[model samples]
Target: MSNVTGSFQLMKSLNRSLVLNKIRSAGAVSRAAIAKETKLTPPTVTNIVNELIESNLVRESEMGTSKGGRKPVLLTINDQEFFIIGLDVGARKIRGVLTDLNAKELVADHAALYQDISADQLTERMTQMIEDLIQSAGVERTQVVGVGVGMHGIVDHEQGVARFAPTYHLKEIPIKEQLETAVKLPVFVENDAKAMALGELWFGAGRGCDNLIAVNIGVGIGAGIIFNNRLYHGHNAVAGELGHTIIDINGSPCSCGSFGCLQTVAGGDSIAERAARELASGRESLLREKIAGKDEINGEIVYECALAGDQLCIDILQETGRYLGVGMTNVINLMNPAKLIIGGGVSKAGDFILGPLQDVVSQRALTDEVKQTNISTAELQEHATVIGAVTIVLADLFTPDLLNAK
Candidate 1:
């Protein structure tokens, strides 16, 4: 390519990126507004915006009425123009969703695993699923920013290695490199709980809150901490292992080989185990009817019964909440976050889980801390972590250097 041609191409790319950034920062705006904010000439803004329109990245909306002359055409990011893929890998299933720039779901697909799949098989299946999602969403290959996977375990984001995931029996696997090589696009791996926390911080209940903590109550308890307006992953990406916190010195054994950890008492498996035993002993409640012939019970079943107002189900939830609250009170004392958000499948019980939770928090937490902090359920439900994964890709893809590079 000619040097002059290359220079012009570089300039065009930088200008387009700048225009896109302006729209992202300001929301729906006019070309004049972008020019003013970016300090670029009106002609440059107009040219860049036209290129964006051709690329389907931005769109022109109705013009506002002018007090004197012609109305200015309003510009808005085409939330539907492009998409990103997000996958949340859980012990029981793999949930994938394709979303637009605004994080609106376009298509979603999930697969259940009877048993753990090998790392290679998992990545291969996940790649196929992503291809299916793109075709299902009718998005072009170039339109997708990348894929982000939220895994349950210690993640080395810098190296893209999943140190270990007990649920999947995976250890020290290069998740990002493998997925990226297979899918031929950028890939990111993050702790599932941390991803959910970012999702909450960006677009869910934690929006506008700088200091927040998101506790994920699922197969096992985990936490996502956002401190000083940034997601805090700690030194080795193990900062939010709240479930492993020793709550009882002689308590029930945990998978981590510890005694009296929060996971021993509040994890989904533990909850199911307790319910099973209670039912076997002929507890008089709807749970017996719900699991009449079933040999095993799961967290979802428990939540359904709890929502149905089964006396035994409510009792279980209340007791679980009490224990969770005890842990949370400690969280408040340690993090002192502005708000605490609860998420994951168990959160489906809503106030059945949160009401008793708060009661305990009030009782155990420092009176002053309790008064200053608030607790709420995650607004994104099961989608928080997945959407947060997508956010990670977008934030990385749209940075000044990357977006502006020719």
Candidate 2:
């Protein structure tokens, strides 16, 4: 096909995919509802729905009882028509999940890496794990639509590349292409925080809502923004670098070559390091004892201690939460998102962190802005990124042309 003709065809396919995706994510709905939700024309939604039904990707359900008119036929996704795989790769662990068309988690598995394996080895292990999962789920390979990967780093999603991921030692790596080639399936790669955002948008806290932000606090801090009812990647797919934002210019050095970034203070590594220091200084706390024999402690240990009412641990978490509140105040002022969801390891500090974090933000942020935005703990926790990977695959399936080669 000629270039222009191919482009037009791609757009048409993408439009159809987008419409179908909306319906699937939004659940049972009529063509009118779909059109209204997606801002597509009624005729266009009708046409897309017809095509999807014919393709066995969507089906019509019982008609809705009308208030004052004819019943509207409800459209539903064909859950058995397709399957998606989501992978979340972290420095300390790797998690994978199988989700159906509706983004429901069907099965999940996790494994820890000994901190020495190379990227190539990680890929091999992931591939093997996926195969095992597919067999265990008893799903046909042909029914598998694609795989989505949530890796920690700066990712160019449009190009399917990880530009700079210190945790994974990845640099300009074509993670999408490599995985797609090996698995013989289309693959989408995204930063872990952004994946969590998608996860919230489709299945978790931000479901059916627009204009939300999900902050992931792990070994590093990152954010995923959903704006105008879409995942916003900003100019270079690095828009939500909340972790790198300088909170103190002359304070501690950050891994991002900056000073006093949120991650440098509140990230898992930083929290653990501070806890270690406190223990070394003979400060009494449960965490101090927990890390006595271990070379290192993680955020999980800190949270556990805080939960047990250890004064030192509670104080550390509250301090971290206060810093996080400062950063979140900036985010709230800039984006004015309707919801701010917090996830990752450090969030396990639970109400200890959330209560203080919310109090500070409420006090510092603009009153009107704070009133409109709801800051809450993430329900999905660590699994948000992996589930979000599944959501991304499903989204691509519904809008294949959006990801076509240019």
Candidate 3:
């Protein structure tokens, strides 16, 4: 009897989720339309819609077009009733955004982090940032459904712990619990690259794309994989650590203690270091005049010099692109995704990097069809991870159990 009861409950939950998702996708839909689209009975759709209306998740809008009778009432998601907060915690900085259910940004802010800051201090700072974001957006704390955090590390989402972050030298940090205690809100945490992928999936380039990869290249490199319209976290929830994948057996040592890792050649730090080394060796270029010293040479400076037609800077980015292409070739031959998105601060180099990167992928990929994967820079640019953080809460809100609950 218990098994039967559980099964029935599950079915009801699934039905409610289906109805809600239909209405959400349609923007404004009628019960008859939802019933028809979901292939559920009219009575079931009516019950779920009423429940959603009571929960303030869905509301009756203007009348729909007539279908040979009285105009049907249209239902729409109550987007303004609640909000979400998304945080992207990087090695050098932390960014936050307040957004609606549709992932539209209402307010955004950021703060820099020194290399020596402890995890506890970082958590406290993040708590204050969340409060400031809510206040800046002019929304009451009660209006926020939850907070989501995206960090660069192996995050145990179920445990709400950051297991490892090599860049920050952090390990086993209880980020979720600490932040929740400080802010008094439900918190969800995930890997930054994975969050960027989710952001693309729902609101950016990956919208309607089931098979895609969002590769983030900044101080370090990582990828977020989407297979069959879902984020693939693997068995240990760390599937997309593409940066650690060794591309050259004789390459420079990586922070991960691995040799020939992709990040050693293609990451922002790697590019900046290579450019600085070249400048120190007296390789004449326009960068010398653009910056006061070699210490000032960074990825952004290199990109700017390259954009201004500096041959050495252009060469450096071209070589970095080749390395990135080598890594991307391996990814393509393995996953065969339909779309590949390049993200992170370094990707801002635009054609100075992508042209060479795409050329390498096209030449090295195993098959012509595999090389056909559409490659483009991230549409959201700096905002991807933060917006994706909000999706964590949105995903929970749309879950079957939550959607069906009274």
Model 3: what TM-score? Answer: 0.93
Reference-based lDDT, residue 307, model 1: 78
Q: What is the C-alpha lDDT of each candidate?
A: 0.80, 0.80, 0.85
Candidate 3 Cα outliers beyond 4 Å, as residue runs: 1-13, 293-295, 399-406
- Per-residue lDDT of model 1, residues 187-306, tens digit only: 888888988987887789998887999999898888988887777878767888999999889899888778999988888888898888887798877877777788778888888888
lDDT (Cα) of model 2: 0.80
For every model shown, what is its TM-score relative to the native structure? 0.86, 0.87, 0.93
Q: Write down the worst ten-residue block by lDDT for model 3.
A: 1-10
Candidate 2 residue pairs that clash:
17-398
Query: In model 2, where is the ten-residue run with the lowest total lDDT?
Result: 1-10
Measured over all alpha carbons after superposition, the RMSD of each candidate to the real structure, in angstroms, is: 4.7, 4.4, 4.9
Question: Which regions of candidate 1 deviate over 4 angstroms?
Answer: 1-21, 30-56, 59-65, 280-282, 398-406
